[model samples]
Target: MKVSAKLFIVGSNSSSSTRNAVDMACSVLGVAQLDSVIIASPPIEDGVNLSLEHLQPYWEELENLVQSKKIVAIGTSDLDKTQLEQLYQWAQVKPNSNQVNLASCCVMPPDLTAFAKQFDIQLLTHNDPKELLSEASFQEALQESIPDIQAHEWVPLWLLRYSVIVKSRGIIKSKGYILQAKRRGS
Candidate 1:
């Protein structure tokens, strides 16, 4: 089975979290390596926009995994032409592909298309929401799922989605989501 995983970093998280998530996925999937791991990191809400600086740490971690043969390829989600160019130039391991949200822009920007073509990076389309899960929605679900838990105090750190595909037939065999959360204070 060919396994692919996408890690969604919802907020400010340590670079090491990427390593931890990959390790967990490998352990669970019982595979020493994954076919690909795509990162979907939301911009930090400090009023500043998403920049290469915000992505460097995460990319570095993924690059390390690639070097160690734990992950074959790495990609990004929701990055524009400018952001993608910055990362591609600065990164030691260039991104193999990028996912553009069709909902945001009905047509893929020509600049992005040209850049991807020039760099030989694959351009993929997706309709995923800007935010997969809002904090309030997450808390509500948690509270309902586990009646006694203090849902409000817990903050979701990251979510990993993995899928197993039948390579020969090009069919998905199984898939699941893994969410990691932490308490507000320690």
Candidate 2:
């Protein structure tokens, strides 16, 4: 049976990222407790890499929400077999699912498929990449719509997945985009 409500939130991470999540949810949709959270940190960033060490804290926070009955499930995004395996072995709550970006390599990686089967973790797909929007690219798009806004100074902060359970309003139901900004050229 459906428990209270299931709120799915997917986003990139940083030191105070989880706090950003709660604030965004509360501000936009009044969501107090999130259900399923999909971690969307790109598997590779510059020289940074995905390791059990990097992912543990995020999963642990999700796990805390699950244990506290604030959330029901937790998931990952774009992680491959080796990475998924390491996370599965180490995570206290164990990821309920792993999302594969269809654009990353088209067909799901064979090894990832095999691993998901063995573990019973659902393998899902998404079109959005970790860099869903880039600084320059978003600015370019915005320039066409609103010329006065300084595209150069604006930077995308985070993206979240939230569903408005209330059907009464029946319009512009759900989504998340909270941007953090910093000036360039100090």
Q: Choose the strongest candidate by TM-score.
A: 1
In the predicted model 1, the residue pairs found to clash are none
**Which residue runs does candidate 2 get wrong by more than 4 Å?**
1-13, 42-44, 138-154, 164-173, 180-186
How much lDDT does candidate 2 score?
A: 0.64
Cα displacement (angstroms), candidate 1, residue 134, comes to: 2.2
TM-scores for all candidates: the values are 0.94, 0.70
Per-residue lDDT tens digits for candidate 2, residues 1-186, read 111221222223353555455455555555556656676653346677777777676667667767875566778877889989999998888887888877787788888988899889999887874566666776787777789887777655554555544345545445545554444542
Candidate 1 versus the native: TM-score? 0.94
- Those runs of model 1 whose alpha carbons end farther than 4 Å from true positions after fitting are none
lDDT of each: 0.89, 0.64
- When superposed on Cα atoms, how far off is each prediction in RMSD? 1.3, 5.0
- Error in Å for residue 69 of model 2: 3.6
